[model samples]
Target: MVLKTFGWSFAVTALGLVAAVLYGGWTAFGIVAILSVLEISLSFDNAVVNAGILKKMNAFWQKIFLTIGILIAVFGMRLVFPVLIVAVSAQLGPIEAVELALNDKDRYEELVTDAHPSIAAFGGMFLLMIFLDFIFTDREIKWLAWLERPLAKLGKVDMLSVCIALIVLLGTAMTFAVNAHQHGGGHANKAETVMLSGIAGLITYLIVGGLSSYFENKLEEKEEREHEEEEQARKSGKKVTAMAVGGKAAFFMFLYLEVLDASFSFDGVIGAFAITNDIVLMALGLGIGAMYVRSITVYLVRQGTLDDYVYLEHGAHYAIGALAIILLITIQYQIHELITGLIGVALIGWSFVSSVRRNRELAAQEALGEKAESHS
Candidate 1:
């Protein structure tokens, strides 16, 4: 299974390399390959988190994630989104902005840099909400139930998340607004725009995140109830059919994967700015990022690694929380994304090794029990 999964990844990686060479040269190929590995390492947590959700989805949705979902990741979020941000911030038309990006690379970089405030604000808040919602909510696993209880109690206050979001909004407003006057005359207006953009980002996070949380919770509850019903049927000696996803469930899964990919791509897309403003280079980097994320999803599914690492989901959520905070800090500080990616890879790698050791230990214990029983 591992070989098969790796075979597919190798094939995709090779295809990307070849395409890069054909389009640009050896430099492009090398860059794409390096960026792909970097993205894959950084996004291991994304794969684990995706597996936690994907297990609830059927095979059809999983395929959609590998197919149509890639389009959104590569083109929609990675390509068009950045251009749109540039256009909106620079007061240029979208087509003109894209042309400028494809032609005048220097200007493109400047525009993207200028637009960083909004990008950081949007991606930061979105990831923050995701991290907090997962951390604060209860899960089926009881390993962290004790920690969850306190958070749940806090959440019972009706609008804890909203209140926290408001504080973040105000803080961003004050920081940018206050600093705006230090630049110059027109610079002050720019600061107001930046502050307002930050608030807009926060508002976007509240709406999308709240709705996603609602649906996620509802689906989880429904699954639990169904599981209970199945257990009852088993107790009654009746055959209980396994629940399979289809139709709307598949659609929802696709949507979930898309959103998840979007979140993961935020860092890579933003970091690509440090490399080159050439849309082609950006696409190469982002495309490689997309390819590896898709490959990781397939790797998890094919190897059934999710079944082995019970704590893997927990680790991923924690990593997501860390990434969120890192992104927020990057707003003011120059946080190298490579550091963030390396940390995620290290954590997930540790979890994987620990899971393997525990599984081996369990197998040995079982073997010892069998041997003793045979002697008896």
Candidate 2:
């Protein structure tokens, strides 16, 4: 299984390298490969979170996620999205934007740099909202119910997230909208443009994120019902066989994985912007990262790693929460993407080691109990 997984990753990595070479020569290809590893290393937590979602998916959708999802990550989000952002923001036609990117490399870099603050703001706020929603919302977990009880009593309010987003939007607007003289000879109007662009990005995130959350919740509820049904079937002495692929369960699972993938990709895509404004390079690097993440997800499902590492999912979610906060703080500070990635990796790695150690201790305890019974 390990070899098969590695083979798949190797093939994709080779293809990425070849594509980079064809487009931008050996030097460019080398750069992309390095960046890809950096992205993968930084995004290990993403893989863990993705694994939690992918496990609930049926085989067919999981396969689709690995195949078609790669296309979306590599081309749609990484390459096309940036181009679209540039064209729309710079008032250049799509053709003109592409021409500038392909011909005027320096200009392309400048455009992307100019657009970074807004992109960061959008991604940061979107992720923050996700974290806050997750914390406050009730889940099936009994413990969570107790935790959310007070929050729920406050009424049907997701107002905190909304209010936070509004504050961010207002601060951005004010920072950019102030007069130049009042701001001490700075380009007030330009700052305002960046701020307003960020506000637009935040609004876009809210819309998309709200839709994603709604669908995710519905799918999760459906999964819970199926699980309950299976349990009841088992109690009645019926053979509760797993359903075939591509059923209602499978479709919901697919949606769940897609949503999870999007969430995990948020940081990676944003971080890719920090490396190179060349959409091609960003695509190549982040595509490689996405492939590795998918491969890791598949391996976890096949091996039932989540069952073994019980705390792994918890750790990943915690890391996501931390990352969301970090991204928010970064809006006003020069927080490095590498730092963010490394911190997430460290936290997840610690959890993984702890899980392994705990498993070993349990096994030892069980063995000792069996020996004691035999002696009696």
Candidate 3:
């Protein structure tokens, strides 16, 4: 059972370990181990969010996520993506960027670090959209009833999330942009760059989100039509439980997941530089962490954990919101990874406890009712 469920994760980790040991000796192995743990600790909430989406996809797509998708997450995001960022931002060719990373680690790190403000802005805005949309939308059940109720009411306003996110981005940019100018030292363009980066992020969220939503809706409609036809053809009434949304629908969902993963990786990649300038070490460490997260995602789906813990989704989104805010703040300041990881884990831990308490209450009520029925 363990192998069937977590085999891919184990395989990926083994490969990553071999690669790490081959490329770097025992000392590098230790650093990779530490970084892997750091990433996993920081991204537990990310795994929850991923499971929420992954469960909605078809089984074929789910397998793809584990197999082909893992390759993208590990190599594409953890490795090539960083090099691409440096190449674009530093105006160097890909070969030169790789060369610089291998030859001049400090300079490469500086180039990556220099781009932090924009990276933070883009990722913050994108993730902020995800959080705001979730909280503001109408839901029959409320997690934090007192807090969520008012937010739901506010959701009546057209595009409330978009407006609020834009206002926050502009406000932060204006405030910090000025501070960055004086203290930032030769970084007078920080404000403009931050604003532009935020806008870019907002645009990315809308485009990707809009496309995914459109495809999902169309797939739903197609399924509904097929169900109706099948019911009509049957002499007796029946319902269709599964859907066959295979091609375009799957592609859009795949796109959405990749983008979401990229957004999550931005913080990790930036923070990894703080620990090590060795690109190979960072990739190997984070790649192992990525595999475990994906395994946890599949486990959550198969176990139906989301259904069991109703408020867990709320907690994950709240964590994402907190991370988004942290990213925005880090635009002008350097926040330690430990602090960032702690904040996310704390919120999720509280939510899990709340879910357990609620479950026990429900169970006790059922037991009491069953006892009364037996007596009657």
lDDT of each: 0.69, 0.66, 0.85
Task: Assess every candidate by TM-score.
Answer: 0.81, 0.76, 0.92
Measured by TM-score, the strongest candidate is 3
Candidate 2, superposed: residue stretches over 4 Å from native: 22-25, 136-270, 273-275, 368-376
lDDT of 1 by residue, 1-376 (tens): 6555456556656777788888789888777766776677777798788877766667777777777877887789878988887798779998898898888877777777655555666666666666677666666653356676788667667667656765775676566534432111222324455456556656666655555556666677778998999999999999997565556656665665676667677787777766656677567666766666777777776666778776676678778777766665555556777899887877677667767777898899999999999999
Backbone collisions counted per model: 0, 1, 0
How many clashes (backbone atoms < 3 Å, residues ≥3 apart in a chain or on different chains) does model 1 have? 0
Tell me which residue pairs clash in candidate 1.
Answer: none
Candidate 2 per-residue C-alpha lDDT over 302-344 given as tens digits, one digit per residue, 9 for 90 to 100: 8989888876765676677677666544444546777888888
Worst 10 residues of 2 by lDDT: 179-188
> In candidate 3, which residue pairs clash?
none
Q: Could you arrange the candidates by lDDT from highest to lowest?
A: 3, 1, 2
The order by descending TM-score is 3, 1, 2
Model 3, range 1-376, lDDT digits (tens) per residue? 5687888778877887878888888888888888888888888889899988888788889888888888998899899988887898899999999998889998888788777778888999999999999999889867899999999999999999999999989987887655552222335447777899899999999998888888888777677787788877564666535454466777777778888888888888888977898999999999999888888888888898988988888899999999999988887677899998898889888888899999999999999999999999
Q: Which numbered prediction scores highest in lDDT against the true structure? A: 3
Score residue 194 of candidate 1 by CA lDDT: 48
